[model samples]
Target: MSRYREFKMPDVGEGLTEAEILKWYVQPGDTVTDGQVVCEVETAKAAVELPIPYDGVVHELRFEEGTTVDVGTSIITVDVAPGSEPEEPAAPVAAAAPVDAPAEEKKPEGRQPVLVGYGVAESSTKRRPRKGTSVPEQPQAAPAGTYSAPPTAAAVQGELNGHAGTVTLDRPLAKPPVRKLAKDLGVDLTTVTPTGPDGIITREDVHAAVAPAPAAVLPEPAAEAPAPVAAGERETRIPVKGVRKAIAAAMVGSAFTAPHVTEFITLDVTRTMKLVEELKADKELAGLRVNPLLLVAKALLVAIKRNPEVNAAWDEANQEIVLKHYVNLGIAAATPRGLIVPNIKDAHDKTLPELAAALGELVSTAREGRTTPAAMQGGTVTITNVGVFGVDTGTPILNPGESAILAVGAIKLQPWVHKGKVKPRQVTTLALSFDHRLVDGELGSKVLADVAAILENPKRLITWA
Candidate 1:
């Protein structure tokens, strides 16, 4: 007679293991219609809003806000048939059978409830209770609007309270790398205070457990002395998760895995700057954003067109250089979440105006933190404009799975020899970093040279294209 249907969290981003529940849009007893957003979650890539698939009245929220729940875990339970008095939520109990009982159904991790009316699959087996630790009898269900803990919660509670010796199947909530770190440092997760969300242990927690700092006892202060600062006031710790965590892992992987070679060129882009001003005045680009970056992107496209061999990826498994005929130009955008490189797909085919529009949209979407996982994948080349920050140039790292990354420096008025005369000109520097395995020094130089040539003489964009 129970109408409770559980909703498990879906993998919002590409193969993300878990997501932190940033907020709950619906609470118990609130009605939610099909396709209505129930909650917002933050994954490793970005924040996403999840919608319920069918009409229902929220019965209970399994996890609290800020809880990092594994994908496929039930976050909410809804009663689809709220018109009638709901019976006790037997779905939770009926989901699993005792270990002593004969097999009736398979474990329901495969049911993958992404919608409203999906059945909660039954578990294949249940662990036996600990000796001398009596299992509590199931309490009678209160009327609707009350909540009950699941079996997993009950077992975990038993282990934590007066049954430390009990053997349970539950593993400690730490990442594999963190587990390895704890093992290496001789720290037991059971003794560490988890600072991460939803009872999960973090690297800092393990480090603290292994090498705890002795509390600094301050002497009583004098009347004129400033009050002794608390530990929180001295420093702050931000959990490195979500987009920032993903970025760090990627940078480390790319830096160690690939052999990078960087080449720099200082060029006078006075012509390119003049072209930008002209483009702004032209009626064709009336509403679109016209800036140096736009011209820079066009020059890169022209360079890539001339030196097609530079657009490639190194496949270590197959021992081959995968040369791509198309170009997915990644533009690095710094967002509050983190640095994400979402590329313009098939950029080689887009005209200058179209490229400008795509670039405009990409920047706006990234600034608003709405860039999707798809937009950031399958990039062949990337450009990082550290120039906007007034930096000269950097040996930028190649984006993973891509062959090259171009770094553009700030443009300033500097003395330069033009037409055999030393005069102030618009000058900027460019650094090209490429996968040495895929692109040799000669090929890398050609690509960098072509780009510099196009920028120095904006007419090359017409000739090359």
Candidate 2:
């Protein structure tokens, strides 16, 4: 006999309760080694790959892919002693199978594991008796492609209904997540044509059903075809499960929990723009990202140095203000999954060239969806560049637990008075939103002013730093 070990789902993110199994790399009867990635799960924060802790033979997969399992639930079972014969599959339970079923039991529920909110029912091979009725027992159908026995009438009916008619019967074959998506989109699974393997309904099927078809063109004498009766859906519902859910919760918490105070300043950044062009031509700065955002970030860091009091967090539990000696600069990035702020660790200690390298790497990693949870934590301040979208400016909310967030607006050529003459110069607006409890109007204004002063005269970076 082989000893079996159940591998439970661990909390991959900070206190996340559940994660949806996206893909399984191994199946039963396959040999696996220690530290091998067995499955990928998507938590509320990000998609993470879970590796097996020890080497063993895969005994069973507890839940099907696309199922959301709670943390601490066993996801896979492994057999350490593999020299022995593989264990026989567990007998199917009666609760999942109808009465009068054949002597050969239904497929085990262990394959399609019970949902997170449901408990496992008792196992019984025999069916329960019904009052005043005795349904005749139906013989189980032979396995597909087995010529030993002919297909049963039930199997014929299942084939007519677009399924193999083994386990799914009349109900549509779909995972729990797909079902939830269908319900959200107001789509009927029975009406949807399944394109998945074994007639299983997929997310794409639901989305396809929601999309409206192109209107048909008719000849003048064709009586108009009665407008086609509007078959497609008007709206599609998407479940708030993974990264999107976390972003919504964080935004709500930050907005209501903290009293935000915003201050804005418009300044001439012609010198900063000129500096950006000059740096791009410099040999040392070649192959590095030299842009307006980089100069803006450097300006903000110089401002923080001048007013260190503004770079502190409010300790509500301790009833004291906690001043941070170092800066872990966070750059707000928007990815396909959701908006995530992955900070550059110890940014205050980095030189101009080093900062440029870190920024390039951070953007690339975020775009590729490879940012880890560790990169998102422990941030003191953030900078969101809404200017890339050609927007003027926005009052950005503070990142949770942070003191302030700066928003950079589009820099356009505007008429400005320089040396008592109106001239076309590069101008942009900056908005700084901070926690009022720790940062008052005076402190906020000073920080915003310093950033503007540097952009107005690029030489001030050396003087201020």
Candidate 3:
């Protein structure tokens, strides 16, 4: 008797309710083993590959590629045992599955549920690590048409035990994540000499050739003139999808719905800067990135604690305000693709060193555009560090559901009071914008003042909080 089992998308990470199917490694009729890479899923935080949990022949695909299915949705159905009747030849194996099944197909409108693990549940609210972060080492090349075998015209099955075979390439093309990595490392993937099968450039090839020949410097013009604009200059338009889509929707939602009010306060932060330097030299904090942002993050956390109203959400449909005790601290980051804020869960519980490490990873991940959609969710409050751009301050928009967002300006040398006398000191401005519907003037002022007070005197944070 033929037995079958369905493989639903598992909750890949902590409380991850759903994920978008990026691509599939196997297709209908292909035999997949336990722990084999089966599909790539883009969670809210990063795009992660899910390995098959059982050995079986792929029977049917539940959802097509690019479809954002809820967690526990049956993505694929497998036949664990060979059936009495011979199975028909399956469709071509594509890197991506069709997002929406055709109307003619005899399938449920929603995806099927996988048999094992937590059944996919309905999730509400649509839409949507850096420094020393080691990129995973790429495996050796695999041949085409064979999951695990040497390159040949005839297709072979499982020739290399469990390995996906050497990929044959007409020309080298890199994935988006790989391309981003190359750009960050200052290496052009096209220029790097490829060693993979059929002249494919792998990560190893990129790491091997560390220093490439520098670009030729153009000679300085004897007399400079304004650069002439080309006639009918070409323009390129890239379609916005995935995180970009969710971001656009959220921005429109917040901008149109929320009544925003911004407040600014400037204070001398010499002590906070001094603390950062001291922490950098401390033995316990060694190997951690000690930056001014760390103190600012901690200050923000403290302010949220004192003024919980600022760490709240206005539930229009529910006709109430939801206050969150735990803080999911969002850090606004700019990447090659667009802006993303991946919050640190339970941020208020972390120590300074722990917070530093989290911020470092968050910034790096966002810049790499690897932040999954899940990390950008459930943020109670946020901090935007405009300091990196050398700007003093600006009114930052509230991150969709969050009640408030704090902006930290650039730290610079300025004249200030010392022992009741004027002197030079390090100072910075803080701008806070809140949803006036949820946060009153007194409450907003207190939150911003609390953060500014911490920066003015780091010792106050230790004593008060």
C-alpha local distance difference test of each model: 0.75, 0.74, 0.68
Worst 10 residues of 2 by lDDT: 214-223
In terms of lDDT, the best-performing candidate is: 1
Candidate 2 per-residue C-alpha lDDT over 9-107 given as tens digits, one digit per residue, 9 for 90 to 100:
876675789988988999999998755778888887667767665567898999999899999789998875566553443333222334445646443
What TM-score fits each model? 0.70, 0.67, 0.58
- Residue range with the least summed lDDT across 10 consecutive positions in model 3: 120-129
TM-score for candidate 2, residues paired by index:
0.67
Name model 1 segments beyond 4 Å from true: 83-117, 120-232
Per-residue lDDT over 222-304 for candidate 3, one digit per residue giving the tens place of the 0 to 100 score:
22244665799676455555446667877888988999999999999999999988988999888887899899999999888
